[model samples]
Every structure is written in C-alpha cells, then in structure tokens.
Target: MNRNTPTSSKPVIAIREADYGRLTALAQVTIDKDLAVGDELMAELERATVIVGEVAACRTIQMGSTTTYKTGTSEPRTVTLVYPGEADIEANRISVLTPIGVALLGLSKGQSISWIARDGTTHTLKVVSVGK
Candidate 1:
C-alpha cells in the first residue's frame, strides 16, 4: 500500500439498525474505557460494510504474519480477519471488535491499508473481494 494514497471519498455504507444495536451492545459489554478505541470503533460500526465468507465462498483477507490471541490457553496463534460469523481463527470465530476486522470494515475490493495490530505490529492488508 502506498503511504501517499488518498483516503476514500466514497460515501460510507450504512449498517442496519439491528446490526448497529448489536455492535453497540457488544462494545458496551467488552470495551473498557469510555474513551478507548473500542468506543470509537463501535460508533463507526454503523457505517461499515459487513462482509461474510465461508469455505464454499472464500474471500481473501490479509492478516498479521505473526500475531495471536488466547484460545483455550494452549498457545498464542496468528489470526485472520474474515467476515463476521465466518472463518474460524483458532477455533474462535473472530468478531469485528478485533483490530484487523475493524480496520477492514467498509473497505472496497482492492483497497489496501496498513494497520496496527493489537500487539503493536503493523501489517498491510488488501480487500481482495467480498462474497455472500
């Protein structure tokens, strides 16, 4: 991704009222501080384009080359951000609250972004495409 690339000018996609409500509830339950990044993220969730992918309908999503999260206390493992409710990562389906998921939200096909991981690592990811 080019550092000089221009930010998107397309109108933000609007999420459904039910989806927005669900995201807001999740944020309130999981987020720590009222001013934390999660707070900001939840506020923007209403404008995100929800993507979903499965084995039958794969959508490539860039993920941290080296990063992991707690999953049954076995070992930290890398995670891939795919559409919500799909793409199992470490046996746990990732939610958009995840760093990569949040970053990828609302992006169109071929759009690339350099995002900071939860562990402070930076990664470049492109939206290859989205599917049902």
Candidate 2:
C-alpha cells in the first residue's frame, strides 16, 4: 500500500518505506534532547506519505536527492539531502536532521514551505527542481 497522501491544505510530501526506519530512529533519539529540531522532524515524518521503495514513484525527494531550491528572494542553490554524518556545509550537502533538511524531505519539484532555523529564524524555501 503506497501511502501517498495529498495534504490538500499543506504541500504534498512523500517518503519511501526504507528510509522510514532510519529516520524514525533519528527522531526517537533526538526528540528527547534539548535544543534539537527532532520534534519538528517528527512532525514532518508524521505527515509524510509512505510508500515502498521500488514503486515510490519518481521525483520524490528522498535521501540522497540533489535538490535545487531558493530561500525567500535569495539566489537558488543546490544541495544533496543527506544524513547527519554525511552533511558538509561547504560541500552543499545538508543533513536531514536539520530544520531545512527535514522540511525538504518528501517534497517534489515546485513545492514551497517555511522552516525555522536553530536560532529561531524562519526562512521560506521553494524547491525548483529534484534530481537523482
């Protein structure tokens, strides 16, 4: 059963069942810590449309997806959404444990959303494209 839900009032987001396992572990560990965005990450996960990996469809922003997005009016930038251990700001790889990274997951091309930074600053990002 592909859990591709259309969150009509909110932007549509989807996730693969395989990644769900690890993401849940991360959330379970982080949510109990102070100053972690784990709660937010958990919320995003809860709303995701879960599907089997093989037939999860195309263009869904799962881990390892190289995505191009714009933050508010800033110039567009591209980054590969990765796990915390693989994140390197200079290399443009973002960790899914981060606020923005968590927000970007399960999103498709042309979707937009506002995410809160660790410092409490809010930023709006629009996904321009998704690439494998």
Candidate 3:
C-alpha cells in the first residue's frame, strides 16, 4: 500500500473469515455486553485496506513504498509491507506480524495511533498514506 496520500474518506475494512471468527470469539469471551459494535467492526474489517493490532493479529498486509515517521523521531523511514512469509526487516520490508505492522492495520491516512512495543514502551505513529 502507498503511504503517501491522505485517506480522508472512510474506506471499507476487510477481514478474513477465520480472523473474524477469532476476533468474535475473543470479544465474546471477554465482554458481557452484546458485541454489536464488534460485529460491525468485523464486517467493516472485511473491506479494510488498513488494519491495526499487534504483530500477531494481521494475516497479511499490502507491500509497496511507504514512509513512516516515528512519533518522537525526526527521521522518516521507508519500508515495504509484505505478507507474513516474505517479511524481512533488514531489507526495510516487514511482515504484518511485526509490531509496527499490526498496529498499522485498518488505519486510514492522516490518522495517528499508538501501540506498545516489545520493550513495553509506547510507540505512536501516523498513517501517512495507503494504497492497494
């Protein structure tokens, strides 16, 4: 996905059947209230171009030239998002299973969010752009 353009309009979120089921099960087990919002979120995830979660949460992510500027860092880094099986950090390409990968899922361009790193430090990032 291209991470240069702004995502102003809300696009559809997509999710795999298995992933949807897993999320639903998790919500059901944890929350007592009716998971209507969670259900709707899953439906929306089906059409999502971006997703947000931990590294282990994503099944796949689009690969392309995208730049990321860390929340408190000045230098912007470019990286490619590859499928889980093809991710290589040394090449500046990462799998969707990585920390930054999952946190970026389902997010639109211009949206800023935070996620905890493996070291327990909070990391914030912004969606600079997204493309399929």
Candidate 4:
C-alpha cells in the first residue's frame, strides 16, 4: 500500500480561495506578533495554492474545522481551529496565529507536519481527520 508521506516532503499546500483574504489578514496578525513563528506563518501563506472553496477537498483543514491530530506518538487530540478572538485553551479552540495553527492551516487528512515549539522543542503533528 502506498501511504502519503509526511508534510515535510510536500512543502506546498492549498487554501480555499474563500479563505484567502481572511487568512491573509490573519497571517498579517501573526507577523505583527513579531514572534519567531510569525515569519514562518507568513511564508506559509505566501506559498499556498489558493483554490475555490466550493471545489476544495472536504478533508482539507481550515478555520472552524474540528480536527483530530496526533503529535508524535501520543494519543490524537481533537481541536477546533478558530480566529484569535475565539481562542480558549480549555475549550480546545486554538487560534490561527499559534504555531500549531500555522502548521495546520491548509493541510489535509493523512498529512503531518514537524515544527519547533515556542520552547524550541521539536514536535510532529499528523492530521488524522478533518470535520466542520
């Protein structure tokens, strides 16, 4: 069987055209943060392939998508990606400006990304499923 490789091997990503504008603004928000991951988020946005929302894959991750993902070998977690204004750690709603959020945007099911955390520790998250 042929399995999709980790996201590290596929540097390109697709974002719904419907989301492009909002996400672009959100990306700017990250840049304003001036944090280490800010530039990385902007880079991801700049390189994304914008697709029309109606034709976009249902499995593609996006804002408001409730996704199940596994970080490293740990148990998979479910979180709803949201705008920064709606972020609440206890509610499991992560902000678009966060590191995990940046890595998760535009990814699809079965894909995964390895990135560095704010603490400089490395982490890998694989997309198990995406739901609205």
User: Per-residue lDDT tens digits of candidate 4, residues 1-132?
Assistant: 101233346556777777778878766776676655567666776777878755474668777888999997799999998888999999999987777887888888888777666676778898999888
Worst 10 residues of 3 by lDDT: 1-10
lDDT by residue (8-29, candidate 2, tens digit) is 5458789888898899889878
TM per prediction: 0.50, 0.87, 0.50, 0.85
Flag regions of model 2 displaced more than 4 Å. Answer: 1-9, 54-57
Query: Per-residue lDDT tens digits of candidate 1, residues 1-132?
Result: 212113353234334333456666766665655424475356456445554433322332322112233223345434454444565667544556666566554444455555556676766655545433
RMSD of candidates 1 onward, in order: 9.2, 5.0, 10.2, 5.5
- Give the whole-model CA lDDT for all candidates, comma-separated: 0.47, 0.81, 0.48, 0.76
Candidate 2 accuracy as TM-score: 0.87
Worst 10 residues of 4 by lDDT: 1-10
Q: Which whole-number lDDT from 0 to 100 does residue 17 have in model 1?
A: 39
- Cα-lDDT of candidate 2: 0.81
Query: Once superposed on the true structure, which residue ranges of model 1 sit more than 4 Å away at CA?
Result: 1-14, 33-37, 46-87
Candidate 2: Cα lDDT at 129:
91
**TM-score preference between candidates 2 and 4, better one:** 2
What ranges in model 3 sit over 4 Å off? 1-67
- What TM-score would you give candidate 4 relative to the actual structure? 0.85
lDDT of 3 by residue, 1-132 (tens): 212112333333334444555544543442345423333333334445433453422333233324453466656565676555677889977654445664555555566655555565767776665544
